[model samples]
Target: MISRSDWLRDWQLVTRTALLILALTGTVAYAGSQVPIGKPPGESEPVPATMRGRFAGFVATLQFDNEAWTDAFVLAPDRRWFAEYARDATNIRVKDLRSGVTLRRLRTGGRKISGLAVSSDSRIVRAVDEDGKPLAWTVATGKSVSSEAEAEGINRIDHLTIHRWDNDISEPPGPTANPGQLISRFLASHGLSEQLPDLQTIEQVTTSVDGRYVAITEGYLGHLTIRDLSNSSAPVTIEWPEDWCGHYLASFAFDGHYVVLGTHGDEGDHAFTDAAAFEIKNGKAKALWHAECSVDRDAPEQISRDARFYAIGAAPNGPVVVWDLRAARRAAHFEGVYVAPIISADGSTFAVTKAASKGRRMLVLRHGKRRRLDANIEADPTGPIEDGVYALSSNGRYFAARIASATPGGKNAVGVWDTDSARQIRTIEPGGDAANSWKIAELSNTGDIILLADKSVFKAGRWIDVTEADESLLRGRSDSQLTPDNKHALIKQDLFLASFTLREIATGKTIWSLQGTPDLGFVMSFPDGRVRISPGAEKYLKLVRGFAVKPFDANAKRQFLRH
Candidate 1:
């Protein structure tokens, strides 16, 4: 017999208390969960499904057994099919997005597959195994291919063509003629004028050392186009040979005078089979030479400053090889699994470590002679020697290696060595609270300075805490970016909600700050008025139509400078 209003008030209070308990206990049903602000519970904490902003609700719930499952799904460009990991994580299921029907199941041969991608035609699915081996499957036939050639062959397009801008013109255009106009005319002639509104998918981009030429590879067809920054009116288009199936890498050498193309195919243990050099002559690329070589996909290929030599190899164990590009021959070969093989600009010195051996011993090859230098640094058997752990100067005069702590719970350090005398020259230790997070160690080209992430900078033979110098804006921040000119920085702090601050590096003054919007996950819109959201974003899309946030515009940088 209680009053109706009094009864409703009591019910509301009980409901609110129940929700608070559910949020704190993480019993929420969708992929989203409420997390506490401040430091994460552990170092390897997974990203929360909640979006960033005050009063912003969860945007999506990511359904996965673990964090690794976040990248195991991909949608085709045609919007017809999508590929995702099966429940077992050992197989991939290609399903039609429109009907929500499973089309085919692809076996992974017991290897866990990740990085799933669909071809442009929606006929093939490609992924990489846990061991870094490439795998592919045909959607319709449910067939699998082990060889690189067969994998690429099934995805090749027959009508792929390259269009050149300067092909019909006998002379360069006058200054009054706009380069944009010329490009527009070329596109119209090729029946691509109406398609200009669509975004062009570029797989890779490389610029010449001199910064004059830029090479762009089309994502789907492997066609290449070279554009001169000085003369944008005349772009050279190079088509891959019909026999070739895929383009692995492209690079510039000899100050933009030579263009090197790496193609993958042929039966071998490696994916990169052919490395070809092309000379730029009269606004055209003429093939100079081609060599049968294998380059590791994960290793970063090194090219000498003068473009006279190239070194390529990878970890665990390696038969590291150095190639003399000018002479078209192999210069030197070292048979051992080494860590971080590097070549000097003058092609006179090379440094690498015998990772499998004990002690901090470095192998130095100078002028065809090999010597071992004892860095006098203790090795941490538990720590893995990753890419950024070691750095060498461009001249090879100085080499830097991360010194692992001698005892457990001890701090790490950096040791610099003079390659000529094979002696440790200096040891730089992390300062303040940054010692625990010290990961990336870098050496300047001249070997006069060292940078330990964004935390510390070693200059003039002294360590300076960069975070303290920058007014501690970057303190405790995991992700931050510095402008190329070193004048400004963007610091991002993610707690319960993400926030960003643009600060002046020298003055340590905050220029602007903004709250980040929640990540709605990956969404693909189709022409047929259908939309597809990733599994992680499906539930979140129903809660919010859009976000109100200020996005950074590159064109408005000048406006920011005025502030």
Candidate 2:
């Protein structure tokens, strides 16, 4: 992903690239205006307001006359979108960009203002809060399905919530922002399975890697259950520990046998805190460990002292600590790094940084000493350099981080660095001392492209073509699904699935864009919210990228982590 300054970037280049692919082969646009390495998207302004600039293309946002309640929004692949909760102390309204409408008088149940997530189709919406609770409501009367709405070829409103909320139960604090149209929130609130009545509060919920099974903790009935999502209803349930904390349900072992739970440790993580570990097998949960932590389980003070969220790598390399649930011992610890970024298809690697002073390192862990990689990077990460690095491609080739310094009175873009040479490759968009650091949300498998986002949904960041290489995609839509080979792309859009069409390699014209009426496609949307369409990846590059962080929280209710 091309990192941007704290300024919210928009979705353009990727959309352009996708358009290029969907069109046909050999359709390339020549560049006229050159956005330099240090050029800000615009000149200085007193505050963070949306404006039209030469480089800031197609900016869109929903703002009230006198309100500071701004939350980021996401546009679905097919154009539907969802807004993060816009808050003041009292009134909470979500806006739709398409019709310039807001969900006034929303019939929501919870007041805690925890989180809100929208599905790609926008048919179903899930709401939750900090305390890991659930809220049900219909925000839109014009184009939304209620929890009880039912229809043919359309998802049952009942099944939609269970499935939608289940995935969101453990929002991982950030958007996935992959080229693929997958979104997850940490506090997804899934409905319970059968065979056990009188269910109360569910502590945690986690879906298996394959999207086959979902493990959830029900605090009310004192049981742990694994639901075979293959069938939404009648899911199987496992037993549980009497005093388990749902907040601690993050993840399990690779083999899926030993479940990792916090323990009553000698250190501060135990003694008084609610953090604990558990081992689940044969449909039961056994308490194994316990530790104290802040609400997010992140250790703000010190690691040996009271660290909550786990980090394995230092700044550029690793502080990563592999956990062995069965042995209940620390596996391997790479000191300098905090977390290993997703690697490329061939097992080439990248890392994330938690530091902010000097430039962080990006190196290849080839058998031993760091072998810094050198590759072409399109744009840098957006934001403060001190916040450290975010999304990196699979190969230890390039990195994205907040732009450290800025030319006065200008916006800022992320800084792309040559991990091998420890030199600045380029500075993307720049502006504002008020810029929120960009989040490294999108990454491609072939290490060809990436996406970056900030606090604003008005603009998104996409780095297309290349500053130094022939990385242009030949064909494919941003919404197109990747063929198994990753070399080709299939552009199919719509809700009912059949309404979607497939486009071939680049020529900048649609090979096929399926026609669908609202009924044939059956798309769910931002429940009468606003959304915009943008370009995605290109097909010309002939590459594929897939990445995921290791599951560290067995007690993971990822819902709490969603942004």
Candidate 3:
């Protein structure tokens, strides 16, 4: 009925139609592949399972069933272990991050604990109860020991305080504690005498960054002993001159080659404190230049990352003096007293909150000039400014401060200021008096501020609410933080079932997650590529060490800086 040419053309048309339909279906499948799994209905499109597994390297070290609450948590210096003591618990539990195993359980005599400190090797945990009694226990044996100062007290007022030098040093003083009894008992109980420091006189003990050298201050004004733990010879003891009343090792040089010590005593009828540096190789001490200024006994001094500069809040209500360690001279001084002075790693910039003429203000000193931050905020003030607490970013790009409200009956607000332009870029009020004097938990290296906004943990610039219910379930939630690269944020979020999520900071997309208590504290990352998290058990923690990959898209990476 039809010609042969006509029939062939008809067949070709049907085949072409079929091919076009197949191509469209293939394109749709590829688009769906980009969606991520477990995304909320309205959050965004999902990321493909392929891409999620691309960065799959999270290894869980410990898993246990334990409830988490507001507790005193401390991570060891080496990032190998951590300790958690709950407010209502009777025992302090220590766990190893690498193995997720209980290292020790130090019993507290039904006393409320106020603070905690851990030794470098995770072998010792010192805790102070509500009654001012400090007890030290060996991690392996859980054998408790007390110093003379801790044993006998008048109002039971023991003047001993557990001090942490920088982030790496946590040395609780056994000052008047019997070293013979403490070390012998620990050695005999653990059968590891050769692995411990065999020395007396622990006015203060600080370990080097590499854990190779141990510096111990004998009496308040006594000699300092630096023992090379790897070497068998006698430890190097550097005696302080007779006039010095108190001598304490402040910090170690970045290269771990020098130690800085502070000396305080009556110098010519006036009490004074000066700092000096000792080269570990030569065992010789060099005195750094003093500011002719008195140091605050309560507030700790701020040291630069390189140990080349020291900013001492010259007595309360005095100007902050910046000392140059390399030149051993006074570099510069500010006009107002600093409650907390922050120094950049390079020693090129300094930030502090000082008393202003009208109210408290924050100032950053750099390039021999001072830039005022509070005056440049964008808010319309209806009243005078009030007190504020500020935290600086690691790169000196931005600073976040929770300043008291300037309007009648208004709540306090948190503002982020740009250090480069010296202006407020963003401001957020968490809607309550609870925002007043908000304690900054952790500021990521990339300038993201993780702080306590009201009762919830606010990340970057937004409030992370996980449920329709109240926030009573999130009571003990500490601050969250971004990894060093800023690509991923470890935020405590409710998976609707008590869990945590590692969201990509740029895209707001969660890359890794686990089911656990919201009361998790991120311990430091180790060189071996392990990331540790606290609250491993109800009272313990687990270490997560795996792939350190960035899963941010190009657009997401740009957004991290935009905000």
Candidate 4:
């Protein structure tokens, strides 16, 4: 089975090539305009003073770049500490989330960080290096909790590998070839699955919540090397039963007290197998329970935040089943193929999109009770992303659904529902020539909705339509710029800590741009159109052009250390 790392490598290659083309052509991928503050839809007058003040506060305090290349900002469960990795991946910083002050910065022994895991109490942190070695450090003391021998054992794997699909089709090479072998021969004659290596030394490591146990799975292998972080014992290697002929597709449960491995075999047979769960106690694992199930190869099991419950899309025309991992049994089951089953971080609620006969529906489960948020809405065959059907709020407090019309041929609308009450909080229906057929672009942590069609932000019963400011009238440009006509020039400064200015060619109108961090900065267009400053410091400024700048923030304390 193909691993996520292989897919990510392929995606990075494609993304790099696409960014090169965009940089050469001097094109802005998306507009980065701030969400506007305005009245709710259909209201002529502005919103109430208190609500307006809330909107202003929302835009100022919370500004996170969603399109950054690195997943640096990770908040601990307690929300006390936020660990941020450098853009170059050389170091990491643990910052106080409440005050936004830097606490400590530590280097990663020259190996780039591939994954990070923090404990629930926000006192311990576990960072996995690119070489699959795990480092456990105390957040309060900045001291290593792991010993040198344990770190060496974690990185002792001599080689890594990934199983190639092409190798499966190769003939057994003998007097007689079976039907499968004949098909493989035919495919090989056509020059398929050639040149790609079957395995390599690149693996992904995942850790438990308390930073005690870690499971290292190679990209192409079915065997798993489990490490006990809190103890000095040797790593334990586990594989599926020989009869299953299973390969490691992904991790089923890699958090909390138990670690479950997911395996996938041939289609229509045992598509997915949880098979067993290992309970970790005192930094040692013992076989606890064996809960086995059949699921499609594409649909892996989804676990709740606290690792108490898990949802699986059953295979071969099966129902979606919710499993109670602690009980080692099935908890609930629902009919039909539901899409995007997301559970709350606390495991208090769960959300999934269902396909109803009349139309598409969103079903939320709270305390063993199921309620359909949108029963009559039309089922959107396509989702926001390639594989995702609908977007669910991270906390499972809300979900976004595209509302199908009650009439057979009526226009569709976008609706946001509150999961607690199973009630539709807001519905955005565009009339006449308005921007209709909208998809959810973002769902903020504060339970606000942002539509992709016009960048309309819906927060606190208000509509902040930014189509005029964000969506330019230019034929090719997709950046936020106020240009009355193509003749007038739009210039921006404050790209760096230094100062810069620009003037229009025909009218000679000077435009001064203010200071913005690399995350919020914009590009500037020169008069002759030959020179242009680019946005996306990591994409254009850092990756392709090889630029590096570290701006100083006086409010944040700084400390650096070598490990």
Candidate 5:
């Protein structure tokens, strides 16, 4: 009787287990099964409802469908990165992160994107199109544009050449004992970068702000390659796509996630046909947004980014239109602002300088009211503002510019004007540099102007005459700064500080001197309680303004550096 009861219980447990297995398998079958959807096993996996690339990591590069060949490219500031094929090459395409995987690519459309900011977290991106003011899609997750199998017809001569960064040193990868350590390791890994003396023949060079990454469109659309600058010399390359018509990358930029491209060529002529925006995923670029624009060209042209606004205007002067990517259309329309519009730092207002007038050249401020501050000094017709010259500052109260006189003696003057009454306030005839050679890059109102000239930077104003040895010591060094008094300077020379000297503001004498290399460059105190020399590259520059020399308070930083 006991054995028979045990057998019945076992049978019941087996039955329950079988039921559970059947349910779980049924669910799995729905998601992944040998049978196809309403079909047989011939269809392996279900096709993605839509295919796209997601930015998965940093340091992504643009890969083109160049028949297994590779091309180097840059992202146009505000447009799509277009990749065209070589004239002799076919089968232009790129791989998924150098893997055998392929992605769906769109090769058309473009629009001016304003209010574009890289996401702080470096995930997604958002932009406003001042022209197409509609809140379309920010994430490069949607949209489809037309594309040809191979981007063939773009002109070769028109494309730009990229300067290659190469190095030849070997070392273990770790925190370096020297600045060039990484560069040395790279050279050691790759051997020597080919010396291309003829590279100069290929003009139209575009480089990153840091002069790090470079791309070239050469020989009338001939060859392209992306170099792993990690090792400057031997750039490891993943070439050509199998299926797509050899589409070589024309230009590219990063929003920290996806790589973007704007197409330009015979294939992509109309707004719907020629330009495109895409994102890089798995080492492949997937198309995002594309639009047809009134602009079209047989050759690719460069576009600038990082400006406050961008607009497409009709020939002549119909209306100045700004396209906002967020709004997806032309957002603001204004007249008189059509010329070169430079926005102030605060974003509250802007100064508009018209394209060279036939006989009239003037500068205007766009606040609530249209205000003219300077006369058309452009009447001389020699050329705008003389070569290398620039206006430093112009607030309704004070306007300064590096100007040239008609006569040779009419040298460049840092002119200041009182805009409230439009009267010349002070004309600082700070001698030096050709007409525009002097640019007032920054003014801390400490009466200092950092100026750049002939590969040399001068800290000038009434505040000149630092120690000669100190100046020589500071040569070839960047970020080392001089105190406003011309006395003490944070010296960065030959990788070490020769010394620091405190100067007399009135007579230009070293009152105190010290030695250290901890900080270098022209001294600038921030309103937020931070003191630094002109940051980074600004050290190699000379910033000229109305006040060639600004008088500063040693303790002014105690108060926030306010406007």
Candidate 6:
């Protein structure tokens, strides 16, 4: 995932690049037509006082074509003047709301303005530059007006929040208690809130490869629980030391007998203090090994299916620590933010991007040796940099990366490569026009098939529209998601109701159906028709053949919210 800072920087870079391209091409008409300048035509009529507020609200939603970067807006206290600042441009556009005309453009002399605020009297506009320095301008004359004290008094809107117009609809009132309290009450009713007074909520839910085991964690406190879905055995809960900070990373080993947990220090600390492997046996968890490591909070971490290796690290410029769980030591440490670090099921092979390199310089590590393969993934300046664009097969014998079009107006494609020989295997390009083009969603575990966002499957060197093939099962559905393996799909029957159905993608056979309310709670279903839901949804959760639901104990409910 791209950080907010990175996303904003990329947006600015793209805007600047577009401007430079237009300048070099000598396209004055193109630039003039795209950018809004001066007063728009027919602004003589004065907006009615009654409608001025509504007009200002409408103007707040307007954006120039090149204003694609981060921006801010401030309406004067009287709503007579509006100030706008675009990160890509070095000027603030002040408009007269009453007359519906551009009043003045305040230049910042190339400094990037990040925030904007208008004075109560509508004569002065204060701004904070990217460096947090104060700047002010006169609205009437477009002259710089420096007043440190005045700038300090202004409350700036640092970043503008842009929401879809349809999202303006008011939503129903939320629960009186916080989400954490509600989750706690729900868990207590299910008899799963033992020794968990600090349990805020279910942080994450991870399932084993075969969907037989699940590992859940309490986000606030360092509590971990592993449950076996194959049998009716009591879950094994592991609680960390009271002084040890929370655990944000947890994953089940591919074999389902072991799990890995990564811990970090208190708030503001990004380093991982310790990562431990636990062996589960006889309904109990025993610590196998613990290793100290530093990993970024947003970094990627993965545990091999064989339970022999675990990889964790930060990105951009952080260490990628690959630990040998069997030996309880660090096997290899690579520096640089890797696009994706994937370990083979057997721990004999690994695929990752080259350390500190531009473009997708891929490297495959086999038997403690590295071989470089230039994937030549093109950069898409018009879009934010996406993570997980590259995927490695479980066997680590195949690699796939989403590739941009070689030329402008060309179709994007996905390239697959042979890891062993470091050779290009094939490039699969989905068919569609530019507007409705198919995007690469996921690469199959084996790297032989690719799933597109439009529910299309690419296999055997051809694209198959699964939506068309399974029309009977998907017709009139609100939303649907095909399993990673493309064998089954989870479908929602309505947009405003909680009605779901699990169906086989190939045969259109309904495996099970469920009906509930919007607040029915968290639900997770596996490709094999196994469904697991939180206690809040248990009352309405119906499964044809899956784990038995625990009866809710109303007597165990606690008043988590204080009066």
lDDT of each: 0.46, 0.32, 0.45, 0.43, 0.31, 0.48
Candidate 1 stretches greater than 4 Å from native: 1-297, 356-360, 376-384, 405-410, 439-447, 461-563
Per-residue alpha-carbon lDDT of model 6 for 306-329, expressed as tens digits?
445656544433456676644445
Off by over 4 Å in 6: 1-296, 337-339, 355-358, 379-388, 433-447, 468-563
**What TM-score fits each model?**
0.32, 0.27, 0.31, 0.30, 0.31, 0.32
Residues 101-214 of candidate 3 have per-residue lDDT tens digits of 544446664455665667667667676667666667665555565533452221111212222221222335444333344434422343334544544434455444334455
What is residue 221's positional error in candidate 5, in angstroms? Answer: 12
Model 4, 354: alpha-carbon shift in Å?
Answer: 3.1
lDDT of 2 by residue, 178-297 (tens): 311121232223333343343335544545432345555554335555565445544344444444333233322111333322211222232212222334455455544433232212
Q: How far is candidate 6 from the true structure (C-alpha RMSD, Å)?
A: 27.4
Model 1, 1-563: lDDT tens per residue? 66886477446533433333332232322235443212121111122233344313312211111111112235565555556552234456554444333444465644665345566787767766555567777665556744363232222111122222223255566443332443445444544445444324444444443344555556634566766655434566665544443343333322234454444432333333223445567767776544333332334244454445556554334556666644535677777665446676567888766653455567888878787777643454323255456666766777777776655676777777787788788776654466545444335555654444555644455566554444232222224434333345545433322334444543434444332112312222221212233223333222211112222233222222121
Off-target runs (Cα >4 Å) in candidate 3 are 1-297, 305-308, 335-339, 375-388, 406-408, 442-447, 453-455, 465-563
Error of 6 at 464 (Å): 2.2
Better of 2 and 6 by lDDT: 6
* Candidate 2 Cα lDDT to native: 0.32
| Residue 87, model 1, lDDT | 24
Q: Residues 1-563, candidate 5: write the lDDT tens digits.
A: 34875477445433433322332122112224431111111111111222122211111111212121122222323332222222222112222221222222211122222222222332222333334332221123212222221222211222232222222236455543454333333333444224333443332233221234443334332443334333454321223223223233444333333443332333443221222344545554455543232232111000012222223333232233443322223334456523333333222234433444443344544344445655443323332233223332312234444545545666655555544456556555556543345455433222234444544444435334445443333332232333322222222211111222232322323232222111212222221222332223122212111112112233322221222
Superposing all C-alpha atoms, what RMSD in Å does each candidate have to the true structure? Answer: 25.9, 22.6, 21.9, 21.6, 29.2, 27.4
Cα miss at 167, model 3 (Å)?
A: 42
lDDT of candidate model 6 versus the reference? 0.48
Better of 1 and 5 by TM-score: 1
